[model samples]
Target chain A: MKFTIQVNEGPYQHQATDSAYLFTKAALEKGHEIFRVFFYHDGVNNGTRLTTPPQDDRNIVKRWSELSAEHDLDLVICVAAAQRRGIVDDGEAERNGKDATNIAPGFRISGLGQLVEGAIQSDRLVVFGD
Target chain B: MSEIKKFMYVNRRAPYGTIYAWESLEVVLIGAAFEQDVSMAFIDDGVYQLTKGQDTTGLEMKNFSPTYSALGDYEVTKIYIEKESLEERGLTLEDLQHLTWEDEDEDWAEKDSIKLVSRAEMAQVFADQDVFFNF
Candidate 1:
């Protein structure tokens, strides 16, 4: 089965990303395919490339990056949410004349339509929230 | 159900803390206008949305749970609750007006139509749907 996972809350507030990770791992372990993982609302924070958590704690951003690289999962960050939260791609950073973009590797900034598309295309759609 | 689009609206916030619940309801209403089949699953603090007779006049927050009652008019009738959440909050079916709570004496695993379910089942609800929106 193919699955689409949506994360709505931001990092640190709830275990949104962590839950996403666990679900993704479980799906893969069960021999299920991950269609996409779309981050929206405060979840856009998960795509921030500059996040640096303490060494003692699990680094959710890095873990997501690793997962994407291993499974070739589509990690989509809502563009509007990203920009508003100061997470921009290089193109967006240049377009807006910002010196930097905070979008992390293994994640791409897109639109809500991608989420809509993911929902329409996937066999199953799961949400991780509080 | 004629190949209808299935939407799962996940409510995660408290009833009056923010506009999450109202905004989610508006989306559901819009989906219903388009003749979509909508289901709502409340988790965490969102369960408070089903608690009855809330007075928000002084808090200046809209009593949004009433809008949930209007869902039937919009053709949205399916509502689900997380079992562990209810247990965690010590809230019983008597605390919620619209909740379809099963009798404690029943032998059924999940007897209530407006039933309580496990976390994995909650996640499965999202997976089973075509469009799952969280608020």
Candidate 2:
């Protein structure tokens, strides 16, 4: 089965990000294809590269980045939501006249159409949020 | 060619208090372009999103309640409002806006788009969907 995971809450603010990560890892381990992981709303916060956590805690963003790298995942952040919350990639930062870009590695910013595309292409679309 | 999937957007929050309601609507508007078998379920506080006479003048935010009426034009005609959610909030189908859509199969006859369902029936609807989006 193919799955598209949607994370709708920011890291640390809600358990959604962690649950989505674990679910994605478990699905991949079970030999299922992950079509995409589309972040929307506060979920875009998970794509920022500047978040630094202490050594003792699990870095949720880093975990996603690593998982994405390991599985060649299509991790996307909604451009509209990311702009509203200031999570931008280099291209977006330059386009919007911002000084810096904070989009973490392995994630790209795209339109809401990706979410619809994921729904159309994947067998399951799981959403995790408050 | 890819098969047409049954997509269901589950709205569980009230409008205005959070961005979920508006963003969910945004997804619906975009998803409509896909031309899939799409449906929306109003559960919990989501029922408030369709209440009539919504005014945002004092709130200083865009009053998007009227857009729900435009959903029919996008071929999104199947809107399922959970009966219990309405009753829990002291609301009825009468309190919601009179949403309608033209039924092309019925010679362009305008028909009510809202379908009130029980909790059990809503659960069945969920089971029948190919994809479920909740916000």
Off by over 4 Å in 1: B1-4, B10-16, B19-131
For residues A9-128, write the lDDT of model 2, one tens digit per residue.
999889999999999999999999999999999999999989998999999989999999999999999998999999988889889999989989999999999999988888878889
> Lowest lDDT 10-mer window, candidate 2 chain B?
B1-10
DockQ values, each candidate? 0.13, 0.73
Best by lDDT: 2
- Each prediction's whole-model lDDT (CA): 0.77, 0.93
Summarize candidate 1's per-residue lDDT along A1-130 as a digit string, tens digits.
Answer: 9888988788777887788889998899899988899887678888876888888988888888888988888999877667767888888888889998788789998766666666666787788875
Structure candidate 2, residue pairs in collision = none
TM-score of 1: 0.59
List the per-model TM-score of the A chain: 0.95, 0.98
Chain B TM-score, structure 1: 0.81
RMSD of 1: 8.9
Query: Candidate 2's interface RMSD, please?
Result: 1.3
Docking quality level of the chain pair in candidate 2: medium
